[model samples]
Target: MRVSVVIAAYNAQGYIAEAIESVLGQTVPPDEVIVIDDGSTDGTRSVLERFAGRIVALTQGNSGQAVAVNQGLALARGELIGFCDADDLWTARKQELQLARLERDGELDAVFGKVQQFVSPDVPEQQRARLTPAVEIMPGELKQCMLIRRDALMRIGAFDETLPATFFIAWLGRAKQGGLKTAHVDDIVVRRRLHPGNGGRLHTEAQNLQTLMALRKAIKAQRPPE
Candidate 1:
């Protein structure tokens, strides 16, 4: 099955090229790579222009990651939808491995893999394990490490534009509500770069609090009646 990989970028001049190159280097490349340039005043545009026909570029006012992802989702044409951050790199066999698993088991709607958080220039490899929640609806989960079916994504109504960093919790809730089976690969398929300029890294406490609040609300809303 064909796949569409969407990357939401903002002022990613320093790392956008590597992000794109990683996808291009995939064993089974994506049918298309869509980059949503959310009004980056830096050299983002110039860099994207250099890629030219290699990528499908979409630009808009500086809305946020949610909006950028939604824009890409709306335009995506693949059965399988994948996400990648502008500052991260993917495993060379990411697409091939993920797609093979999906093809083998056609019933899974969402699949995630291991990821390491890169805190500095020398990013060390960290082994991440996947945890399945007992209740199947937990907070503090859902992240930038998976390939999801576009059909399931659309059913969940795309990414929530309301909450920013914590929207993953909401998406997971939606997946639960939709009865989508969650699966994961054991390899470290994605690398999360952490630096001072990174949004969540700079405002860790604030974003964490916001995400916690969002998670609480989702759990309460989904909690069974006592």
Candidate 2:
């Protein structure tokens, strides 16, 4: 099956190229790579232009990641879809392994693997000292670790455009409720980079509130009517 990789970027000029290069260098390269520039006021657009013919680049006005992702999804034409954060890297064999599992299991809607976290190399020693140490490896259900069938994703529906921090969490909750079939592999498919601009770190309070709201919505959806 053909695979399309989508990346949503905002002020990621420092690392976006690495992210795209990783996907381009995958053992099984994606059929297409779509990147949505979410109104970045940096060198990101120029960096994307450097790739030029290699990617389908789209630009929009300061929308959040979910909106950018939705825009990419609308243009994707592959049977299998995968995502890589603008600042993260995918292992070379990520697609090769995930695609094998999906091809073997017709019923599986998505496959995910572990993620390894590391501080970005450009982080200064003093700044890095204040940051949390990297987790060697951890189970990752994040968008970056997923290789999903487009049909199943469509069934789960478009991501919640309102929830900037927990859109994926809310979408995953709905996917589970919809009985989406999924699998996990033991290998690390993504290298999650930690930098000062990391969104999770920047929006902790909002994320926590959104997480609670997503959980409550999931709970309500699963409840039986009287």
**Quick one: best lDDT, which candidate?**
2
lDDT of 1 by residue, 1-226 (tens): 7789999999999889989999888989999999999999999988888889988998999988889988988888999998888988887887887788888898988788877665546433351111111232121123457788888877877777877776766777767876887787777787766655667655779788877877776778788899
Note the Cα lDDT for every prediction shown. Answer: 0.78, 0.94
lDDT of 1: 0.78
| Deviation from native of the Cα of residue 152 in model 1, angstroms | 1.0
Window of ten residues with lowest summed lDDT in model 2: 127-136
Off by over 4 Å in 2: none
The local lDDT score (0 to 100) that residue 3 gets in candidate 1 is 89
Candidate 2 C-alpha lDDT tens digits along 114-193: 99988888988888865555566899999999999999999999999988889999999999889999999899999999
